[model samples]
Target: MISVLNLNVQHRGAMSGVLTLGSLDPAFEGAPAVDGPVQLDLRAVDFVEPAGLCGLAALLELLTQRTEHVSLALSGRNVAAYLERMDFFRLFGGRVEVHPDVSSLEERERHNPGTLQELINFHTEEEIPRIINRISEILKGKEYLLRERVAICSTLSEICANAAEHGTSSFGAFAAVQAYNHIVSGSRRAGEEVIISIADGGPGIRETLARNPQYKDHTETDNEAIRHALEMGVSSTGELGRGGGLTLVAQISARSGGSLSIRSGAGRVTVYRDRKNSRNVPPFPGTFVRVSLPRHAAEDRP
Candidate 1:
């Protein structure tokens, strides 16, 4: 029998959720590699951001490859409904089994085409704008300022482009966006916040960076690698006029009072409100990036 893996709900809302998912790698690694089913318990999970779902999908993808079967036990009615609305079952389909077996995957897919579009995998460069345009529409619906939308889209475009060019994954890269109502702490006003997550199962940042002769001497730990990658003008390709994607994302996060978190290999970095923190955590197989952008008025643009 496989031990049940419990996911934390408090961390299931944004960048924190991606880290929470990364922390599970060790547990899964320690679990016995039996042919029987492994259970993922999501009973305590109350909130799940798009980043969380993408992380979960990546974890499930890894688990499905290693184990013979995998099952999910959802906590409550609300969580079940949330999963249904997100079309989680349809995405995984036969790869993951839901306990108590609610709706057929085919039925869910047929009814929830719109939600499925929010979580997508892209392989070509042309598909990047389609994802960006969809996210722009969602942000526009929330009344975010045009400048803010442009900044967010620019950051997203860079990150997605990086994934396509460097991720080197046969399965391609995954991008997901989730918008939800959140309270702005000091203002005490409810506003819409959107989280954008892009992940790929490929050689992580450290391995990629080591390819450059200049960076070869850096002796980067995973955290250090992520930090270096975010530095302006740093590129694994050793090319000039190229390599500011992550730096732009960081600037957007700092200026807008948002947050950016990236996990590659065993290192994790979070930048929020102009402060940056880095640490070594459980190793994630590939690269996972989540950017949280809160609603900002037109005048708030920097």
Candidate 2:
């Protein structure tokens, strides 16, 4: 018998739905071995941003590992088309199955102005610089100010470097970036924002930091470990002048009046310019980072 997982897409407007990392919470609970084949039903999903895209990719990777066959059931043409533009099929087409075959969708142009970077997979630190360079080039062509571009690129490079160094899962890491013309979530729905999401399957922050005896107190909980990891010069390696990348990324987001969120194990923490918030959630197999950089109208180049 095939196990079916119904995705819980959040309602954003009257008729549109958004798939977010929190939307996939149900699938992570009561983790069970996938027997036989599996199906991910995304018929309710109307749109997927960078965070959701990366989350979905990570979920698929997890499922495929337990089952030889996994299929996706997509509903509307728009959702399929959006995924196609994001290069979702190109990365997972060979391994995973798709319903309502997207062959026709694939024939369409593969360009989305809002997309700064498409779904990308990387395994080692050696690939971080190239990925950063490509996105930097993309941003250069847009109307983004030099400072905006620097913040975006720095956030990506730092998180990606960390992913490559620590995300040891066989599937490695996945990242995606999207620039929304209008704020998609949160209190405001009118400002432009860029979202970057990266997920990796690894031992997670708590376990990783536990490797260092000096971080024993900080590693007591996933939230503690993540919070401590955000401090400048703190790292599992405990090497001087190391582990500042994430701190820098957090600072960049804060300066932009955006936010940085980290999730691992059973903890989720979000850092803002004024304060930090933490919560306990379903265990994530590895570490996930989502950064939001909002573009103020006054600051954007005309």
Q: Which candidate is the best by lDDT?
A: 2
- The reply for model 2, stretches above 4 Å from the true place, is 12-16, 112-114, 185-189, 299-302
lDDT of 2 by residue, 95-187 (tens): 899998888887775544744788989999887887787667665654667886787787677678778888899989998887777755433
lDDT, candidate 1, 129-175, per-residue tens: 99988888877877777997897788778788878876576656888
The model with the greatest TM-score is 2
Candidate 2 worst ten-residue window by lDDT:
183-192
Local distance difference test, per candidate? 0.71, 0.81
What residue runs in model 1 are displaced by over 4 Å at the alpha carbon?
A: 10-36, 104-117, 184-189, 296-302
